[model samples]
Target chain A: MQLKRWLNNYVRIWGVYDMAYDESEGEGVWIYCEQEKGEIHPVSYELLNKGRELADDLNTHLTALFLTPDGSDAQELVYRGADRIYLLEHDNFNYPNEIPFRENIVKLVEDNKPEILLIGATHFGRSLAPRVAGALETGLTADCTGLKIEKGDFVQIRPAFTGNILAHISTDRCPKMSTVRYKEFDESERDTGREGEIIDIEPLEYDGPDVKILNEMIIEDINIQEAEIVVSGGKGLKDSQDFEIIEELCSTLGGTVGSSRPLVDEGWISRNHQVGYSGNRVKPNLYIACGISGAPQHLAGMKESKIIVAINTDPSAPIFDYADYGIIGDLYEVVPKLIKELREG
Target chain B: MANFSIIVPIKEVPDIEKVNFDREKGRIDRSSATSEPNPFDLNALEEAVKIKEEIGGNITVISMGPPQAEDTLRDAIARGGDKAILLTDKGFAGSDTWATSYTLATAIKKLGHYDLIICGEKTVDGDTGQVGPEIAEVLDIPHVSYVNKTIERGKDSIIVQTEVWGRLYKKELKFPGLITVTKDLNEPRLPTLTNKLKAKSAEIERWGLDDLLDTGDEKHFGIKGSPTSVVNIEVPKEKGRKSKIFEGKDAAKKMVEQLRKDLGGI
Candidate 1:
């Protein structure tokens, strides 16, 4: 006992003690605010809304780590919920490069030591978060659907085994981190009356192999996740050309076109139009499933929508189990008729 | 142009589509399902093989799993890999992305020389596209994710097309870099009969924690090295909704009316 006590004292004096779970060390909650072309990703605002609540639970301040080329307005982040902003402006931040971004973010986290770090699980966030976590040697949960503070522990909830199981995860290390999925939570209301502080962080010089962006192909922004109405198709379509009827119905309803994984895999539609566990998770106000048998993976993506209407010929289809309304009919006949009815009405 | 040495990391995952769920038991019966190479990892290996064909090079396939994962490595060898290595040990089980990446990076470092590494966008069972970038970070190399097409291969650099969000970017990265490929990269080829026969008798190098760890610290491996743990796992409760069925001729009209009512006149 005496030797163990002496060894503990020696380790503490030599600063070799394991600093894994020191509750007094880490402070504040941080959200990495991702921006593209001077516009912040909507998911960042959503995280800010959720981060604010988590910070309130921990009785700690909320900080937004904003790294942008043009130094886009940080005040909006403040109005949304962040108590402070860590602004890092550099021309290199224009494109999504993981190296420098990871370096700077890791340095900031090491310096400030935020207790909880949240990032949106976009393509960039998915790439950057892991690098940052690897550098810090900390744990990171990916594509979390829910996050909460329980008994002073930050708990991350995510789907495992292709959305069949939901796992509640916790990190033993400080700076508990998670990459939350988009559209999982609502954004906090912006209050112009709110005031906050913005601290400027000096950008670090990086000399690694640089990734140069030669050209950017402009693709139409298909923001299906933010759509109010979504009309999705599935294998029930006789041919790829049958998507025209689904498109007509979607156009008539002024909604977006979505498809099950098979249709997307068959090249009938683009991946952005896919709604499933592997594709986009959409929480639109109204979701219309045409000929979709509703596999568990597909249901996991869109079941959270306000209302779901399933159209299929088989009454025994699993879609009916989760659909708010079920229509037993051929989509080819039903979709065209629905379009005509909407046109006439 | 010099020949490139490419490394591809693949994973064996339970066939998620075929896995059965016991609703009463509130658990997934993964044992009933067969295991297969992660679909996207095949795309990564296909890209690596394509690169080897275009430019004279060697391909090394690596994986971390149980002893049975040797089958996955042999399959990769049959597919086009010139060599295969399996990093399997009892100490490497239950590793999160961080520990898994660290272990893979250590193995890659011990392998000596490589110009490029390729990985799938994500695993099917884990569904976390994290290990690739984490590996690159541990190695202090540049990485690009969601790469759909390889544009050009130069002496010391390569250009590729990647997608972020909804935009397509043409990016150029130096050698000794990593890329996580998407399904759009290319269709994987089936193993040839001759190659399959050759792979049946091929020797695969098996490495354990003792081989990779120089510090003799087992804490950097397996569940002990992992910082994250699943506290609880539960089958997601079905959010049952009102299943109002409409049939006959007015089904479409009824759906439209109900949608209009719920959405306050669409």
Candidate 2:
């Protein structure tokens, strides 16, 4: 106990974590406000609300780390939930390039010494957090779905081995970090009138190292993450010829078209269009399962939808148990008619 | 010098099926679970092996798990690992990804001389996919993730393709960097009888915390080295869907009508 106390005092004296670690007593919790082309990502807001809860529990403030090319997100970040905002603007930061982003974020955490750092487990964050954690010599839990305070420290809970199991993990050192998966937590309330501070930090000139983006191959598809309604087809669609029904219905419904993993395997759809344990986890208001047998793996992704409607030839399909609505019939006959009727109505 | 010097990090995760969450206790039950090499890591190893095949090179595989995890190392040997190092210690328990990365990074620095490090985007069990970049960060190397294809390769630099939704980023990175490959990159090769025989006799190197951390601060090694903690874990509670069943030809119209009403005709 004496040695532990000594180390605790040493951590504070050394201020190695920038006030982040005084052992059990934390400085604050910070959330990275992620942006794409100027628009803030939804996950950032979700994290802010969640981070606020954590900070409040610890009697600490919640700060926002906004690295952007412009001040577009700076104002909104304050109105959301952050008590303080660290806004860094730079040309390289316009895109969440791993190199400059890592360098800057690591410095921010080190200088500010927030005891906890939360990032969205989006493509960019996944790449950036590990690099930051590595540079800071701190622990970062990735893709966490649950976070809470235990004995004055934050505990992160995340899915392990894909969607199979949940692991409760902790970072014993200061600046405990975690990258939260999208849709893991509901977006919290935002009050535009909520006042907060925005500290503008000069962006250090960053010439990125070794890696460079040479070119890009673009394919337009629905942004499944932001979609409110998703219509998914499975192997029962048989082939692309039958998949047309799903597409047409999706278009008529003004929603995105998603598919089960089997359809991707059968070469009927691209991997991005897949929604399952191995694919996208969609939390749309309504998820329509057409000719899909609700495999547990498939359910792992979309079972969180607000309303599930399953259409299958088998009435005994496990999907019915989870679906708010069920239709027993072949998808081919049902989809075209549904599209035609919806188009008319 | 070898054409290419590489390291692949592997993990032995509990079987996906055998994993169960105890909501009441806020824990997972894996006692009945058999362990297997994290499938994603195999993809990384496979990609590294293919690169080595294209040009003559040596590959060193590393892992930090229990003693049983050594079996995963031998399997990597079967796949194409020329050297295997295992880091295991009682203090390493519940190290989380950061500590795990630290322990692994320490081992890598100790082994020295590596042109590249390949990792699965994530492990089946850890599912964090943070270690590869973390190691690169600790080593101060650049990293790119979600590469589905490698377009070009050479001794000093390489180009790869990242296929995310709506766009595929063709990126170039100089050597002595790290990459986390996805399954879409390539199909892994099955171990041949000869490689299996070789793996059976190949010796495995084991390192404990004492061997890795020069600072010798036990607190900076495993559970102690970690910063956060797991407060609780439970299976996500899924609300029951609306109980409305529709059937026959009229089902389509009726469902659409109901949806239009519920969705405010979006």
Candidate 3:
């Protein structure tokens, strides 16, 4: 991939303030963009959209770093709001192995010390960011719901206390860091015509042989994220038997099934089925909730689901606030009737 | 084929959740409560011990809190850590994520060589999930958070399996990596009596403001070095409402069918 340069002199505004302060005290913001098989994930773009504002507010140039295999699509990183792209490409990096990727990131960060680093809370970003932060001996915030700049520092804000509270944090010793969850903010349009500088570096290699993955099984069936129809239940179901009914309904509708935190906590469902702030964010064309009371934490996870339908005896349930269709009656009676009607219809 | 170094960050905070808050009094009644290692950090400790066993290496747990946090250090050593470091100073209080990250980065630098640092994705108290990444930033290292499995650790790199949306991803990163593991990473082991005995006299190192900065790095330490502050704190209101319980088997059956229909079948 060819590296491009933006040469935006506007960043010089912050440079002048730095001279007025202490030349030794300089900081910049970095965004960790994840790429796989020469493809930049959309989550990285979303993060760039968020990081751009933070960097601009902190008065620092936004740099995007992409780690991928050698001869991969590294050039594609520059068009995504990055003032600079640090590319580390290698054959080993073709498939993301945590050790090699993280080591390469350590080298990249040490070479370029940014004041604040933002990463998308995607699978790759989540797994890699923490270990690198630890190796560097820095603190990191994860799954940030909001971000802002206060007093020229990147203010990383996220939900705390089981999504019950919000906490704000900033770094002082330079290079503060945080990871933002997907869909946490709207993705800004890419300035495709905007060219930026890209620096290709060799991936850091580690020496070890203690672990190995013999093989992996790829299931092409279930695509929970992109499922067109989703059936989600919560703690309101109360028992395992109730779950069976929910499952039957999902089967009839040809939809995947999901649960609230309580179901996972109760071991009634695997965490894969959890739908909430700490769980999966789904946007099915049709989302159905059974017996769910609509706790904010649960809603936070599934509020994005389109055509939400809530079935509960409680007419004033919070789930109704965001739901388009509400059945203010017993789920048991309404469900069977609806099912028969659907079958006949 | 042997590479290992683990760093653990500790936090000591009041058990605000279980605290009996007197709304009218606008305070918590701290009469009956105790503190424990943040659940995620405890999981980190367990993961560290497992890694140490798999690949011979020393495990060090570090914390930047009050002197009382020493209890946590001792507990960590008791569990399975090879060493414990506590950086406690009154000036450290009210420090935001940035300051905390700064202090931790400084402490680890003072401690020296490391290959991998493991920590909880987020702490119970702060829950920002920033300290770990911030530390990575301060030291300028690579990191991953919310990992599910280390698919492989090769002589040259480590491959990991992490969850994204509803799918699992197998990715690789080089060594000297920092990772924040989730509770789902592994089932953390409980402490054994042998390790508990070894921990009793495990000379915990205590570093103060002066100890951290022989070079005046102290100027940008603790809350003073932190940029963001907690402008306001509010307890999230419980989403409670009127409830109705359906009675009888017929009612239960009806509810089941309705739920089934809601799910898209009968």
> Could you report the DockQ of all the candidates, in the order they appear?
0.74, 0.58, 0.22
**lDDT by residue for model 2 over B109-194, one digit each (tens)?**
88878888999988766567788887787677888898888988777877998853236788888888889998778878899999
Give the per-residue lDDT digits (tens) of candidate 1, residues A3-65. Answer: 757866786676442333344678999999989866799999999999999999999999999
Candidate lDDT values, in order: 0.88, 0.80, 0.68
Select the stronger candidate by DockQ from 1 and 2: 1
Real interface contacts reproduced by model 3, as a fraction: 0.21
Residues A101-165 of candidate 2: C-alpha lDDT, one tens digit per residue:
77778777756777888999988888888888777667778788888987765778877544545
lDDT (tens digit, per residue) of candidate 3 on A1-345 = 122112223333333221012213546778877676556777788888887887778767888887766535555556667788887766655555456766777666666667777888766666566666655445566777778876665666776644555556554344566778776677657667978788877665566322233334454545566577888877667687788778777886778988887888778887777887556677777788888988766786677665677778787788877776666767677666556545554
B148 Cα displacement, candidate 3 (Å): 2.9
Candidate structures ordered by TM-score, highest first: 1, 2, 3
lDDT, residue A70, candidate 3: 51
Off by over 4 Å in 1: A1-23, B1-3, B215-217
Ten consecutive residues with minimal summed lDDT in candidate 3 chain A? A14-23
Write down the lDDT that model 2 would get. 0.80
